[model samples]
Target: MTTRVIAVGGADAAAARLAACLGGTVCPLAQRRFPDGEHYLRVLGAVEGADVVLVAHLHPVDPLLVDIVFLADALRELGARQVGLVVPYLAYMRQDRRFQPGEAVTSVSFARLLSRSVDWLATVDPHLHRHAALSAIYSVPALAVPSAPAIARWIRAEVPDAVVVGPDEESGQWVDEVARLAGCPGITGRKLRHGDRSVEITWPALQPWRGRPAVLVDDIVSSGQTLVTALQGLGAQGLQAAACVVVHGLFEQDAAQRLQAAGASRLVVCNTLPQPGLPLIDVLGDLAEAAARLIAPRQG
Candidate 1:
């Protein structure tokens, strides 16, 4: 089926790339804020009887979530048969479980809200810390596409003397996979989380991979505390100023400046999130592949 791809907010560029991949038409959308700061959205192209894919970069999430639901509903009201979402960097997965009393589990809630709003969903390597997969929280046909292969390829082509270093134990397996694919050795560090911005990392002995250039790898780089600490730890071991590779680059506030000051030689991230002046590793192929698979012809 020929699908119609519509992007909300700052996802027009990504939507264009995915549309090219899916062999879909890029549907025009008009969105703006009112005097009182309320969102307004309208689908300019016809979507009747067509499969519509909503492309969204859900960082700075709350407002986009609101806009997307409205836009999805608009598509349905305009006679669209199905609505799917392609959120490159999905948000709210961090709060999968409630550690404190009376805290809201936004992961499940966000999934519920999104599942009801769209028919199917696809995202690039969502943070699945507690739940095993997207099926655990989302009721719709949703999937997380892996970016390891793409990352590995980038590392092989770019960083010749790369030694993959995972900042924390949570990323041990992930780091190993990337390193194996990149044909480089990998090591993981232990982390004791004091808070969101505060973390204590225990670096493993650096004797084995001492002279090689380090590349700190992780799925997400929000606030960049973990990365900052990792750079310092690696530098202390005489491993030279290391580079950073991340899937989602949510460098909030002064995080980017901080990472630079912390001695990160290079900061590379996937095109999952739109940011200015940052080198992007293309993951649209993976996203398009997964999204196309999910929306493929379903036989009765």
Candidate 2:
């Protein structure tokens, strides 16, 4: 069977890389918004009877979700045999449950929406809080690709005498894993978020590694407050801010500036989103591998 990779808008580079890895053709998607605020999308190539891999990063989830559904339905309508999704940064995953009464479980709801659109799904380092895995929420075959190995490799190669630090207790596991792979010491701090832009961070005892370069690792850096707070705390403890590593760098508003102001020496992120300026650690290989497994013929 012929496998074709489709790069949705904003995911062209990632899709191209995946296509090269799979040795498949790249299908382009033409998208635009109507004057009335409606979206219009069209697959620019033939997909009849072909296995389609839709490469997208559902970051600003709203319009992208619409685009995804439209694309998937169009492919199925055009007689595509299978549809698989490779979402590098799956959004709306942070809201796993309802904190307030009458609040919606958006994680499950979003999972259901995507599951209905494609046969299988793959994502990189989704913000999996409260849920153990993506499969716990998604009804379809869902795979969460870890960025720790790649991040660790980058850290090992770039940062000397690196001491991995997790911004909060929630990131302890990921921080420990990266440290283990990089063969460095790891510690996690405490974080208290009062609002979107307001946060407080308390670092653990860093007296042992005071002069060592500290790399703060987190799954996502949305508002960048946590990272800013951590960077400030690290500076106060006499540790040099080597770098801030994140899987999904949703560096909103003044995030980049504030990080630098707080004494972050460098900022690195996985290529989950289209970040132009910062260094992007490639995760396309990992995404393609996972997608290949899903689209491969089932063993007897």
Residues 5-59, model 2: lDDT tens digits? 9877688888889998887899877899999989999888899989899988776
User: Which parts of model 2 have CA positions greater than 4 angstroms off?
Assistant: 298-300
lDDT of each: 0.89, 0.88
Candidate 2 C-alpha error for residue 259, in Å: 0.4
Worst 10 residues of 2 by lDDT: 291-300
* Root-mean-square deviation (CA) per prediction: 1.4, 1.3
Worst 10 residues of 1 by lDDT: 291-300
After best superposition, candidate 2 residue 237: deviation in angstroms?
1.2
lDDT of 1 by residue, 66-121 (tens): 99899989999998878999999999999999999999999999999999999999
Clash pairs, model 2 backbone: none
Give the TM-score of each candidate: 0.96, 0.97
Write down the TM-score for model 1.
0.96
